[model samples]
Target: EFLFSSLVETSTAAELAEKLRADVSPYWAVHYRFGKSAANLSATALAASSLDALLINVAAPLRYAYLRQQGTEDYRERSIEFLCGIKPENNRLVRAFGKSLQPVDASESQALIQLYREYCERRKCFFCRWGYRFLSLSAR
Candidate 1:
């Protein structure tokens, strides 16, 4: 909500950074403690994990969509490169997909997610890479 509300068509990196900084609330820092000891708790305003997840799932995908719509390859490739740079999020879906192939970064993870959602779930084996390979062989 905060990101989309603040984001504009011409938003700059500095502007986005400022919005993130401003959106941070200090109430948690003053009121909350993780454990009996303060040493175990985080005092920072920003949650690194949450931010990383947002960047991977939201920002990168939106960037790819925008770049793809513009019919350009450079920035589209850069967006994928950004995804490839980030670490993959660990979850049941990712783990399930990992049974057959390992995802080295967010790009591979995202690709696997798309494959599962669009092809596997729909049982569109003919459209999937591995599935297509086996299907072609059996058709011969």
Candidate 2:
């Protein structure tokens, strides 16, 4: 867990899965047969599985606990991209932003997703770039 957390803190999303698998393999090999098969796992599958496990088993409970004690402020910077109930398009859009924006970190990605949900999904066009342009043109 510590190694996984360290990788999360230091590695990019692309690097996290392979790093986690490499780092955990020895321990896994000693304890479970599944660990032996992990070597054949694709990076995409590993990342998705690891993310699901972390979010469901670790992050959700921790967020709930923190919310109970101190409220949302404590988790304001945390990423909710993979959490249940979020639309998959939000995650895909964030990835697209990363490609176009070139270096969108977790917090920035979260902010972009929030902006998309609040403005794009809700059709708050005047507040968004394309919307503002459209509104201005219509006004003209």
The per-residue C-alpha lDDT of model 2 at residue 31 equals 50
Q: Would you estimate the TM-scores of all the predictions?
A: 0.60, 0.39
Runs of candidate 2 with Cα error greater than 4 angstroms are 1-45, 48-61, 64-90, 95-103, 129-140
Residue 132 alpha-carbon offset, candidate 1, angstroms: 6.4
Highest lDDT: give the candidate number.
Answer: 1
Q: In model 1, how large is the Cα lDDT of residue 51?
A: 59
**C-alpha local distance difference test of each model:** 0.65, 0.49
For model 1, how does the per-residue alpha-carbon lDDT over 10-86 read when each residue is reduced to its tens digit?
23333443455533345454445443334344555566556557767777767667767777657766677767766
The candidate 2 region of ten consecutive residues with least summed lDDT is 81-90
lDDT of 2 at 19: 45
